[model samples]
Structure formats: structure tokens, C-alpha cells
Target: MRRARVGIDVGGTFTDFVLSNGADGSLTYFKEPSVPSDPSLAVERGMAALLDRARLEPGDVELVVHGTTLGLNAIIQRRGAAMALVVSRGNRDVLEIARCRMPSSYDFSAPKEEPLVPRDLVFEIGARSAFDGTILARPPVEEIAELAETLKSRGVAAVAVMLLNAYVDPTLETEVADALASRLPGVLVSRSSQVWPEIREYERALVAGLNAYIHPLLERYYATLTRRMGELGVAAPLYITASNGGALSVDSARARPIDTVLSGPASGVVAAARIALLTGRQEIITFDMGGTSSDFAVSKGGEPEYTTRTDVGEFPLILPVVNVSSIGAGGGSIVRVDKHGVLKVGPESAGADPGPASYRRGGTEAAITDCYVAAGIIDPDAFLGGRMKLDRAAASGALERVAQRLGMTGEDRAAQAAEAALSVTTAKMATELFKGLAQRGLDPRGFALIPFGGAGPTHANLLAEEARLAAIIVPPGPGTFCALGAIMADVKRDYVRTVRRRLSDDGAPQALAATIAGLEREATDWVGSEGAIVEATQLSAEADMRYAGQAYELHVAIPAALGKTMAAREVGELFHQAHERLYGFRDVDSAIEVVTLRVRVVGRVPPIAIPELDKTATAVEPKGRRRVFHRGQWLDVPVFLRDRLVQGQGFAGPALVEQEDTTTWIIPGWHARVDAVGNLHVSRG
Candidate 1:
């Protein structure tokens, strides 16, 4: 009669589920092949299978936290609802002029990104606001009525309102949006300030526009999912994971779908951080390699790094999100020889439908997964715990084609091609990892790589060796780690306000305190409204500070205790210290300008206790041996069943630890040990 909390993550190829028992804290993991046409179908199918496997009924579930890439895929594929933008007069070119920066500096032929809303679809309004929160202009109701009629005629399913200086005072813009919504019965309406009330008009407008663009698609998906869940007899409250490494109520997510766009990867990073803290690792890099791409996120001191600036497809996103960078190819990334006779891994993926040639779907091209099968790293009959059988001949045939394209004539040409392709992929990932760490002034040698996703553990050792990383921590059930993360996430949200004023100003101290206090009130109110999901609440604050005349500002954290009581001088000192730490110098003599204030609220959830694995005094033996192609030679490698390995067990490479979800490859130069929590700690000799 123990209640279960299910965490689900919908991926490109599979839908992952993690069921945590409320009474004993034991966990169960399951993965189902994704339904590309309707992702909710996979969730429904997976949930039923998982409940049956665990001998639990749907009514026994207490909560369900879910994360999806539906909104993200819609935006990336340009398949979201047809949306129109309503902006202040003379600001019709906001998205068009988008910082006026070209995507590539070296490629002159690079085309600019297509704006979400076309120029023809963008309507102008007289509503405008001044920086001081004063209404400069307001459009007549008749004008708004006419605009709504025009939008309806144009067949836009949704509309976004973003007037000039709407961030300062959202009232006028909200009124305009409300007016439009009243006229347009079925169209969804969104206003800039309600979405993200930052100072930048372009960024604010994009936030609202992006929210509206994906709102209809998500609404339909959520509705279908809710109905399906009910049909399955589950009455638990549903929570959706957010981009900021947190969870939001389904209602909240429906209102602001943009916040959930990056939730998929963010969930993995969140779980990685939790694992880092539990393992006492101070610095770690999370490497998530799924079907479509490989992503890397850095965590320090048990917390994942977060950024206010990131790219969503071709658009710039200013929303604060767990900082995750897409590094290189993944399992289904195509392997090909370019016309110049140079081998390339991918920027194009085969995805789930065709998947890899090994899946025996319709794909005829060689992919990374096919290379694994061709290279003997993956056992064709043992894949997915024998749930699905892979075709080794089809995989080899695909690689053979690529080998022929490379003009290789040996009988082992396919194996050679796979080894070469993996080498290319590893090199690309290592280079990108180094570049990302270098930008943050971090050393690759200082961090342990924690890899998850279906293919992450399978490729971790190769990446670590190429990057010269000291170690890797392969967590238990790596494939379903993101789903586990969804269960561990707390209810969280961020609030921001732009208050551009120099600390030297007479009223700056009171203004800063007042702005922070107001944001805190809003944050607390939001957390309170999240219902029984929150066990306790915490608040943190930060300010965007810069020297007067500086083009950019640095985000400086203000201590929670001093948030309301800190004077202007103390705040300036904190900024100076932060600047010194980051840039190695402080412009102490310069006047400090506070451009924006940010507040983050976190609602704590009861932690799930993962039981430790049983220990054994006897040395573990290999389950079998597999012939693997390594460094141009085929070698017989010992393979261990991951489930049979006991805690405190130690082993050396070259070896393969096979499990239901993934396989861990320990190269010849490394050693591995199992921790109490069943995580494999692999390190160089």
C-alpha cells in the first residue's frame, strides 16, 4: 500500500520513467520507445507497463512529475501555431533587427534567421510606456477592436503584445492584451511583462512571442496527456519540469510554456548536481548523450551553473536556465565521408523513426549506434536487455558503404570505418568540452565527468580519455537519470526587475531594497500557490551590477540575510569583490550602476532516499567475454553484468559493464570501483 511518485522524461527516441516508492524510497526505471506523432502515447504506454512491472495500481500513485521536449521540438522544427506579434508603433522591426549580429562572422553567405512572426503578421499599436512607468500613449478601444479583427482575418491562432517600455509598467500593455483577448474569442493572447519583464524590448518581445507560438501546441498535448492519464485511472497531481532545474504545476506550465522549453536537459543537470553532492564530488561535468545530440553542463560545489543568456534554435533566450551546452554528435548522428574524402560524424541525426541502421528500421546510412555495433562494442542480441534485437549485418553493411566511400578495400573495412568514426566523434566532443571549460576559466583535469542518457555511459570513457579527464562517475540507471531528476526537483521560479540606477545616487539604497522586497513578496506568493508540493520555502537574491559607462553588467549574488538590510555601500563592495574575482581587477573608483535585480524562490520537497547496494567480500568475476575493436585491433574483453556487481567491488580495463539501460566501457588505461550507492567510479591508472 505504499504510494508511488512517478517521474517521466520524454526524449527523442524513448520515454523514460522513474517510480519512487514513498514508504521505502526504492526506485524502479523503465524506458519505452517514443511515439513521434503523439509523444503522450508513449507516456501512457510506459506508465501502464511500469505500474504492472512494479505490481502497483494507478490509484496508488501520489504524484507525477513530467518533462517533455514537445515545445522545444515545435520551436526548433518551426511547426508551432501561427502566431502574430503586436508591438508599439515604430518597434515593428524588433525581432528583425535582433541585436544586428550575424550568426557567423566568417561565412558571408550565412543567411539570417527567419523571425518567428513575419513582418506581415506583426501589427502596430499606439500603446507605449516610459521608463519611469508613465503611460506615454494608449490606443483607442476602437483601434484595438480593429486590430483583433485583422488578426483573426489573418488566421493567427495566438497573439503577443509587447509595447515599448512595457517592462517598466505592464498595466497599459496588459490592458491592450486583455482588450485583444476579449475581441478574439479563441486566439491565445500573451503580454511581454507577464512573460518576462526585462528591460530589453527585443528580448522581452521574443519571450512573449515564443511563449504564444508554442502555447497552443502544448495546450493540446497537455490536454491529451491529462485525458489519457485519467483514462488510466491515475488521479495524482501532474507537475511539469521547468528550464531552471525545477518543477511547476501543469497550470503554471500551460500559462508559460517557454519556461519548459529547456527542461529536458536541465533535468539531467539537476540530477547530476544532486549526485555530485551525495558523492562528495566538488567539481563535475555532466555529459548527456541521447539520440539526437550530446550535451555538457558544469557543476561546482554541488550546484549546477546557470546562465541568463542562451540560444533556443536560432533565437536568443534571456530566461535564466541551467547552463547546458550541446557539444557534439550522439548515438543516432550520421557518419559519412564528405565529397572531399574527409570523414564527418554529424550535425544531422537519424532520430527515433529510422534511428540507426542497426535498429533495422528504414535508415540505410551509417550512424554512431551502427558504428558501435560494427565495432563490436555493442552486442546485437543483448541490446535493451534483449527487449529488442539489433541487426549486426545491417549495421556492418551501412558502415561498409561508408568505408567504400572512403576508398577502404579491406575485408575489415566496416570495423575500420567504425573505429575511425568513433575517433572523429570523440575528438569533436573533447574539443568542444575543452572550449566550453576554457571560456569559464576551468580546467578539464579538475572535474570528474558524470555521464547519463542511453548512450552516455557507453561513450564516457572515450570522451574522458580524449579530454584527459581524471575520472568519471557512471551513476546507476544512467539512461533514466533525467526522469529521476524530475522527481528530485523542487518547486522554483525566478523574478526580475530592471532598476537602472547608480549606487552613488541619493535614493539608490532605498530603491534597491524596495525593488528586492517587492520581488520577494511575489516569489513567496507564487510558491505558496504551488499547493502541497512544497514542504518549505527559501529565497535568494542577485543584482546585475556594472561600472558606469560599461556596456555589459555582471550578475552578483547578494546574501539572503542582507538582501533587505544591505546599504548601497555594502552592495557596491560585493560587486567590486565579484568583479575582482572574475576579471582579476576591480574598478573600485568607478561609480557602481545597478541595472537589474533578480530573486529566486525554491520550495523544498521531501528527499527520496536511495538505498545502498549490498557489499561482498569475494572478488566479482566477469559474466562473459566480448570481442571489441580497440585502436585498430580486435581484443577479447571481459564483460560484467552491472546488476551482479556488488558495492565496494573493483575492476580494471579494458572491460565492459553491461546493464539493461546502457553499457559502461572502461578503457585499458583506467580502473573502476563501485561505490556504496552503485555508481561506477572510473579513473585513469
Candidate 2:
């Protein structure tokens, strides 16, 4: 193979790698234990291993794409740079006020989430702009100078500026931020318009704050990763995956880490959508079961749903991100009995350090992986190709504590506990899947489950059965699917601005046209700066509108071809159509208010070719058999090596297809077949 490209995805428990050979479309996968304290170390080690596995020299690599949740982790755990916020005068409490809505209005005891920037750290000035892009007031140079001095004295690492109505025009805020930045020379500075630019002062300010908060941390990680790659003699251009299911230049990512927060999950969903495009499975749900948590995202018509109303932990994220819902349980998720004596699978994980009880680490707590072992779903001896040994007895002993707490006794007590834990985990996943799908007015039965991750395949059939899904599609390299997805990402960014005006007003059309034109220019310039890898760029326009008296807005897509000539009637009709599609009805008589306008910039990257299976091969035979507990009993099941399976190879009922990374379970009454691309297609017989 010549000119190899590599994709690396860092999960909570393991770092996965996928190497693509440009010569023959071959792919090689490998994984290494993730070091939470030093994630880059795992990436470096995995890169070397992947190169060796693929029999390619480091110099042969042309590109490297990476996906990480480090920024998101930092935000959720609130472990980031000490940041200060700059706001418009009289709006010092915007962050605290937060739409005047509590997380739970009825729960009097619920504590408010601490703002990323405390009140003391929030500085306000009279830098303001009007709704029509006019400067209302500018912070005095003397006041700006004083604020910068105070920030420097306080030893703040980064600063975010959000003047009132800055979305109307960023010039005033940008000028003030630039002045402050000059006074405090080294501190990083971000402006709301420069970051997300969306309206809803609180969300826009938080977006800028979040970007500044996580910048230093992600910047350091990227520096380390790039330096290590250089030391390894690899000259490949490095790119980072974005939450919009695309890749961004290292420069873009280093400047804006917030864009990469949900990239890891988004990458997997991107891969699933690509699979759907190739195989004609328009309705599919991607089940990404990683080490810490399992995430599910739905794709229809070969595209994953995107949302701007997402959250990172307790904070709101207004950027466009592929919609993925996380389930609490995963491979490393700790399993225990709650105070009520009911088995609970986790909201906490052992991570990679102690990992699961079966990993033979120092862990004493049972995890989802342990349950896999106790149930015989994962071959203890064959785990990770036996490079690391697992102690089934330890796994059982760990589950024993919970089994005892649940008042169970018997030789198979631990097995029963494991089964119960799996049931609980599966039920929780199914219920969450149902709810998430219901929000879109979709039914789970109409969608096929595409499972990918360390343990997704092993548990997919169980989930499908419980959720009453139509089928399961296990991608060839299920374990490294996210990494695979990373290589296929495009260069993307989203821009938003609030345009609060009634569509019926005569001047509203002109204002809307001007706003969209400005946003398009920003998107175009941003896309142009995203490096040369973006062969072509396209724009998708959208507007969030609501009937005059409606409480919420419905987002409607605008045809990119119309550009600046868009008419008010056209915009209203688009909103009406969107409303009808979402709610089954539209009110044409109701006056509409354009709440926000959005622009999505996509810089298309060249496609990566996937290897086609060697179709001329002979039929394969079972590699072995193992006794697995199923439906409350232990029964012998055929086990086949995944690599041995060829195109069109078929298997049936309660069989295990084992690969180094994961295992796919074909449940009873289900049949499995390998497609041309070697994806395992499983459906009820």
C-alpha cells in the first residue's frame, strides 16, 4: 500500500486506530489502553503499533485525523483554564439569570449549576450594539484599559467578551476585546460573534466562555500529540474531527476547541450515515457503546440529525452538533446494587486504569465487561486476542457482592446477577432510545440498529430484541468504527444570528436578506481559511421561526440558491412547511417571527475507499464453540473468527463472531450474513 492515512479516536477506556492504505483500499485496526492522565501517550503508542501492524513506514503516512472527547470532558468536569467573562453593562447577571428558567421548576431542592465564570470574575462595560447592527455605545478606552489591568492582576488565562446584542454586529465587541487583549498581552481572548454569534445572550456568552475555558487545555494536548507524531518521523498533516461530523484544520481546532466537544460521537454517527448511503438503509440508529458511556444517534435518509440546542453537562451548547444521546452504561461502567437492593449498572465507570473487574487489573467492582464475562458473551481467554488475560472468577466474585445484596443464592448466583445487570442496562438503553426517537415522532421498529464500539456488538442483539428493532448491522471493524469515521469527516462550521422581526412587516424581508448575506460572507471566509484540503465548499441556510404567539421556534431550511434575493413570502412558506412536517399541521394565517438565522459551511474532503471483501474465497468453518448463558440457561454456541468470514457467508442462531476488538452475538432466531463490504447484517429469521 502507498500513501497511507490514519484515523485515531481516543475513547475513555481505549484509544482506537484505523490505518487506510491508499494503494489497495485495505484497512488495519489496532487499539491501546487509554491513559486518562496523559491521553496523548496512548495516541503515540497506538500510532506506532498501527504502523507496525499495517507494515507501513511512518514516512508513508500522508494524513492523520483524530477525534477526542477531552474538551467535552474538561467542560463537564469543570477542569479547565481560569477564565473571565466580559459583558455589556447592566447584564452582569445574564449568566446567572439564564432565561429565568431552573432545571426543574418543581424541584425546590435542586441546586443551580455554578456558572463557569463566577459573578466576581464577570466584568461589564458599556460596549453595546442595537438589533440592526448599529453601535449603541462603546466601552470607554479608559474603562477597557482598567478591566484589562484587573484581568491581568487576577491572573486569568483567557477572556470572553459578549456585549448586549453583539450578534447585531461584532465590530464593537471585537474592537473592545482587541483593546483589552493589548493591555493583557498573553491571555487568549474570544468574542461571542467570533465564536457562535447566536442570539439569546446567555447561550451566546456561554459559547464564548466555554471556548475560552477549554482552549489552553486542548491546545496543550494538540501540541503534545503533534510533537510526538513529529518525533515518530511522521510528516502527515494532522486534522481534528468536529461536532458537526466533519474535520477541521489543526489551526481551527487550536483556536476553537468548543467545536470538537461532541466530535467523537459525531464521527461514529457520520460513519453510520455513510454506511446507510452505501447500503440503502435510510432509517438506522447508530449504537456507539464505548468504555464510559454508550451513545445513540439516529440517521434518516442517510444523514444524522443535527441540533443546536444541545448541552455539555449542565451548560447549554448552541453550536450545531450531530444529535447523539448518551446511555449511562458502557463496557467500563460499574455495576452495583442500589440502596433499594435493585441491581444498577452505572452512572460511573472504572475507566481504563482499573477498567473492568475481568481485566485482571486492581479493580474489585464489577463492570459491564465483567457481566459479559460472567454471562460467557465474551471469551475470557480471547479478550483483546488474549494479549491481556481476564479472570472470570474475579468477575464472578465481584458480581457476588451485588448478588448477595440482592438476596440471591445458588451456584449460578453471580450469573443471575450479571444477567439482571445486563437486563437493567438494556432496558435503560431501550427506554432512552424510545424517548429520543419519540421526540422526532419516530418508532424504533422502523429503524435498524447499527452497533459499533468495544462492546456494542456483543450487546446489540439484546438491545434490539428489547427495543423491538427490525435488525442489526455490525460494521466490519466495529471496535474501531469511530476511528474509521474520523477519516471520512469534512471541514465544517456553523454560524447563527437572531433576527427578531415579524415576517409580515414590510422592512423585515430586507433586514432578513441583509442578515443572511452577512452570515454567508462570514461562513465563506471561515470556510476559505479551513485549509486546502477542502476541495469544494457548500452552504446550507436555515432560519428558526415561530408563529407570532408560539413559545418555541421551528427551524426551517432555506434554499442556498436563493441567496440574498430571498423574499418574505418564501421564508414564511418554508417555516410553514417545516412546522407541518414536525407537528402534522401548519397555521398559514398566523403571523411568523424570524427568531434566528443559521448558516452551515461544509468543506468537502476527498472520500476514503473501503476495502471490498475477497469474494472468491471458499466457505469458512466454525473456529470453536463456547457455552454461553442465554434465556436463563447455558448452551453451547458456535464461535467463528471474524477475519475468516467471507462475502455472502451466512450463519444462524446463537453464534459468536470473534474479532480482536469485539464480538458480535447472533441471538437465537436471528440470522447473520456478510455483505460485499464484510458488514455483518443480522435480522430475525
All candidates' lDDT scores? Answer: 0.92, 0.89
- Please write out the lDDT profile of model 2 over residues 1-685, one tens digit for every residue: 2388899999888899999898878999998988899999999999999999888999999889999989989988999999999998899998999877777889988888888899999998987787787998877778888888899889999999988878867889889888988888779998888887767789989999999999989989999999999999888889999998988889989988899999999999999999877877989999999888999999999889998889898888888899999977899999988888767888899888878888877999999999989988898988887776789999999999989999999888888888889899999999999999888889888999999999999999999999999989999999999999999888888888877889888888878888888888988998898776788988888888899988888878888765475687888888888888888998988899988888888889888898888889987999988988887889799999999999999989899999999999888999999999989999999
What TM-score does prediction 1 earn? 0.99
Q: For residues 116-178, could you state the per-residue lDDT of candidate 1 as single tens digits?
A: 899999989998888798998989988998998899899999999999988888899999999
Each model's TM-score?
0.99, 0.97
Look at candidate 1 and tell me the lDDT of residue 235: 88
lDDT of 2 at 221: 97
Model 1: residues >4 Å from true position, as ranges?
A: 616-619
Give me the overall lDDT of model 1.
Answer: 0.92
**How accurate locally is residue 554 in candidate 2, as Cα lDDT from 0 to 100?**
82
Best by TM-score: 1
Q: Counting only residues 3 or more apart in sequence or on different chains, how many pairs clash (N, Cα, C under 3 Å) in candidate 1? A: 0
